[model samples]
Target: MLETGATGPSAIVLNGGSSSGKSSLALALQSELPGSWLRLGIDDFIDALPPRLVGAGGFEVEADGAVTIGPAFTALEQQWQAGVGAMARHGAHLIIEDNFVSGVAAQKRWRKALEGVTTAWIGVRCTPVVAAEREARRGDRIAGMAARQALIVHEGIEYDFTVDTTNADPTTLARSIAHRLAR
Candidate 1:
């Protein structure tokens, strides 16, 4: 839902379940666009958090033992806003990769955070089997398959474009996003 007057190269945000090629596609888009675009990953913020601050499984567990992602998501939104601002200032496009599907409330919070930004959310659609296999291969603290499945459901409702990446190459997916931005 971005308008033409957005004043940037149509920012792309890849939001999807774990192991759904969000990171890969974002990185590919960054490479393809080169100096004209910037890629930001939520993992970069999550992974850099102090170890003790992040609890079991490390998917933004809050101090209340609840699997809350508000803090991390706030950080991501702040970063995304900054990136958009920077890109607009420098006349470049922006791409952000994130698993923003914590819950309905979480999505609402993110929507509020993005009110002023010119952004589009793209979901990388993949089967549960493929998602699990990719998550296992990636070998990160993704909680578990059930958690990933839950995330997929949440993300499915929050995307503008759902690209099935089970058989597509990362670069091709990136091109599709780029084409959207270009249009």
Candidate 2:
């Protein structure tokens, strides 16, 4: 079990690009971890929004392959990022999954929000080719998004650990992370 202090529960933040297997790792980690751990992600936040607002300010991929997210989506994303930290501080053992694009304001906001919590920053990595393949198979993501995000997500950040999803199975990776957390 995590050592709950004045700040509340501990957190593991999984940062990666689209199709990096963050959600799979989170599920595996939950199964391997000893105590209850809540899984939260951008999908969760997006799912919570009303249908009309879901894509209102979200990303758009142009014919030329450019991707852009509008201001309204950015604001909502920021709120969700901060809310993950708040949930941890309020006593939820959380595994937060996010594709943290570089130069985005939400990354800095997330760092600040998690300051007082017992947090581990984990990087989930995969080759762009593999990510693109996975994204294509999933069919839930915008085309070319994985390639675009692969270039920007991990910039200017350090992680306690990194898991490359390209070669390893989720269970194996989860067991490794669980062991580290147990130490």
Candidate 3:
């Protein structure tokens, strides 16, 4: 559990495989957690980024079909870290939802960025079959699921809490997170 003092809200990272409900989970955390929690989605950061940095061609598509973020990851990370710092100064909890693929490197980065705050990672798991179905229903782009899954396979193991979102609704999941945060 994160310490709830004058410093800030507990910080959490929501990440997972395709269709694992990461975005929805983060949105819920913003409301479920006490006080006001700021959310930083890597997608939003990337989408709003200057076109110059994104470049014409992006990262190579892995065999798993995941679209790896190119140099944009660096920009997003910098912005996210800055946001976390600012939020901490204001005493706000931060919940970041993004597909930060890779390994131990990311864990270290998270630790450094969220220093002095309660921190945890929530990983959602869903089979590829389930992923595809949800993608269709969620109106995801043609390649979004595969890209998300590839990133998860590369990064999910680093998380502290792994949940299977295949059966849980957003409210149920939010309640579950709230229960945990309360502890």
Candidate 4:
């Protein structure tokens, strides 16, 4: 079993692009894990933001089809990630679902904050075609977000484990992760 450090609880970080089934897998893992596991994600932080700040130029699409985040949103996201780290340090068993942009400064911040903590870095993968279909069906995501995010999220990160959400069921994947955690 993964050991919880003296200062805090261990974490399972699920990194993926938009509509890549991170949230679904997080939920399934929570349900299957024996102990209490706090399921946290980008959406949780976003939901805490003021309604006016949420969609007010938080994201921008460039002429080259790249997406950029606004400064205001970036600050908020940084704070949110810091909070996640603080929680882990204070003994919160967390499952974090994040649609991370590879090579971003925030990625480095995450690495620093979770330093010395027992962390399982999981990559949630999905084909762009499947992600797009999922996004369209959800209707809660920004247009072209999946395609844009698919280009950047997993660029240089190495995963302790990976799940292809396009083909495997979330429950089965969760069970597999749980078994690994138990070992």
Worst 10 residues of 3 by lDDT: 55-64
Pairs with backbone N, CA or C atoms under 3 Å apart (clashes), candidate 2: none
Off by over 4 Å in 3: 1-9, 55-64, 147-156
Across 9-75, the per-residue lDDT of candidate 3 in tens digits comes to: 4677776655667778778767777778778776676677667655444434454445555656565
Ranking by TM-score: 4, 2, 3, 1
Q: What global local distance difference test value does model 3 have? A: 0.65
Tens digit of lDDT per residue, candidate 2, span 22-141? 999999999988789999987787677656564435655554334566777777777777777788778788888987763445557677777678887788999989998998999887
Candidate 2 residues lying further than 4 Å off, grouped into runs, are: 1-9, 50-58, 63-66, 102-104
**TM-score winner between candidates 1 and 3:** 3
Give candidate 1's TM-score: 0.72
lDDT of 4 by residue, 41-106 (tens): 877877787766744367444544356667788777878887888888787889998877634565
Q: Measure candidate 2: CA RMSD.
A: 3.4
> Residue 139 deviation, candidate 4, in Å?
1.2
What is the clash count of model 4? 0
